[model samples]
Target: MHHARSLTALLLTVLTLLAASACASTTPGTGSVPAASEDGAFPVTMTHRFGTTTIEARPQRVVTVGFNDQDFALAVGVEPVGVREFLGYPAPDRPWAPEGVRGKQLPTVGSQDLDLEAIAKLEPDLILGINSYIDDEAYGLLSGIAPTVAQTADYPEGATPWDKQTEQTGQALGRSEQATKIIAETRAAFDAAIAEHPEFEGKRAVFLLGSSAAGFYNLGADDYRTGWLTELGFDVDAKGGEISYEKLDTLDRDVLLGEGIAEADFKRDLVQQLTVVKEGRYVGLGAFDDDFAAALGFNSPLSLPFLLDIAVPRLAAATDGDPATTPAPYLG
Candidate 1:
């Protein structure tokens, strides 16, 4: 009996030891050791107009004073802790912001003016901006908060193509490869759409925006929005013609006018003056559901994909016969 009791006690001790060993071997929450890449030095260096910026390890927290920068960061799979307030013109809602970032919960730092004090409160490891809005004075202020980058292209400070801007910003965030992939994928998607709808080939189109004060600005060939249109194989209007703030007597060739204008007035004044308008070739594009026109003004990384999606269908409709059904022939 004594021998049997001693044996049972030994068995219980062995079982306890085994259970404790198993529990230790299995990680508590994740079930595996944390990856080296997840918790190691991932240094990246970026050159911008403000100068060289080096970030050690991936930034866990980010802030953006510009919409485009915020968009790029989201595309590369990072959500900014803070971003500029959703300006009203680009869709009453921020359709382009990441699914998780919406409503008043994300915190807004006022407009593009960049609320430095508000941003400082967030304690972000990185901050990003673009175009003339981020001047040397702003840069000094932003850098004091965190690493900041600005647009570097020579083509009028604010007019860099979306793809180029994305590539540059992605590099700064240590996600150049991912950026390249996104761009290539987006281009491929566009090319496929163009292929599916051959009517988009060689179609002439225009982008028009009207201000409450400044009549209307006709987007020229050099404009970033035009570059997007041209990518889908549209023949963009020449910027050589002067933009008139005064009421126009005529609308001309292959005009793609903005919505909100009285169609009858446009027909009588602007439409009758242009030869194309007389021929009934004018196409009127309304405010896109995505607020693409307003988004373009901000020119952020978040807006590029939205721009492509919006332009593709609109261009297809303007050039193609039945936007809902049959594809139309090219209108060059």
Candidate 2:
């Protein structure tokens, strides 16, 4: 649900196009294979939205142009030379970055305002924009600088699932087997969490970001934040089509998650009309909390473990269907 408003707009525009075409089968394209070395690595080709980019050998100098691409790279044992700077927040550090990268001085690439000159100066052998908005022009430029990998062409812009990004990233870096293991372990963690919280099974849930002016906004099915809930065995209810402000009261589900809702807005008559709110099944993720926002934006292997710790118990308490019980405190 990172940038939920912008993400929803992109999804609506591409939903019909995606439905018409069978892009689900459009896995990342693979090009020519490199001669395997004793390590069983190299010359790998990674297919993405832009086109097939071949990495002749294992890349030593890497740069990540996407918001969380650095996290993905670090999780797989590579330290990027440069990473995209997170806007709005004062600092650029990610809470879930591995210990090795926590204090390292990684140069910054602009997200909203890209610094092509800075990226060029880094002289990276591999450029990862896998989870970012890399247009044809940017791709051409970045590819010229180094082999560039953009988001999956099949999925809508900015909507590439995190797991797909992670897998593709690993492939590009000649670490497919390691990436697969990381993904399996993350999935196993989710499975274990589900096994522990039997109450979350088949429970209807909705994730929302609320404000006084916009009311409550649903992170639609396409958003990874909601998708993660579905992974944890919750039946997530996503807004299929545009639900106007007036019709917000009609949103029905058992477990309601509200992010960034002010206490005053919670007291509003219209907001209180929702069934979940009336039943005291709403879990409030604090507006000022940085960790919650970071989890929504960066659902990577390193971050998912932290997210599971917070999300499972709150979801369990919310869906228990008991008005007398309240969820544990939002630890994040």
Which predicted model would earn the best lDDT?
Answer: 2
- What lDDT does each candidate get? 0.57, 0.70
What lDDT is reached at residue 41 by model 2?
A: 60
Candidate 2 per-residue C-alpha lDDT over 186-297 given as tens digits, one digit per residue, 9 for 90 to 100: 8888989988888887877777775656566677777766778888777765543444457776666778787777788777787688788888788877664568667666
Could you tell me the TM-score of candidate 2? 0.83
Locate the minimum summed-lDDT window of 10 residues in model 1.
Answer: 27-36
lDDT of 1 by residue, 1-332 (tens): 01233333344443454445445532221211112223333476667677877777556557777655666666655666777754444322577765655543556665635555566566666776754356665666567657776777556656777787777656666667667777887677667877877876776665555423434566777766567667767677666244553544332434364533444545444445655445444445444333655555545546656655655554555454532432222221
Looking at model 2, report the run of 10 residues with the lowest lDDT sum: 29-38
Count clashing residue pairs in model 2.
2
Name every residue pair that clashes in candidate 1.
Answer: 68-300, 68-301, 71-302, 249-269, 250-270, 251-270, 251-271, 320-328, 321-328
**Residue-pair clashes per candidate, as listed?**
9, 2
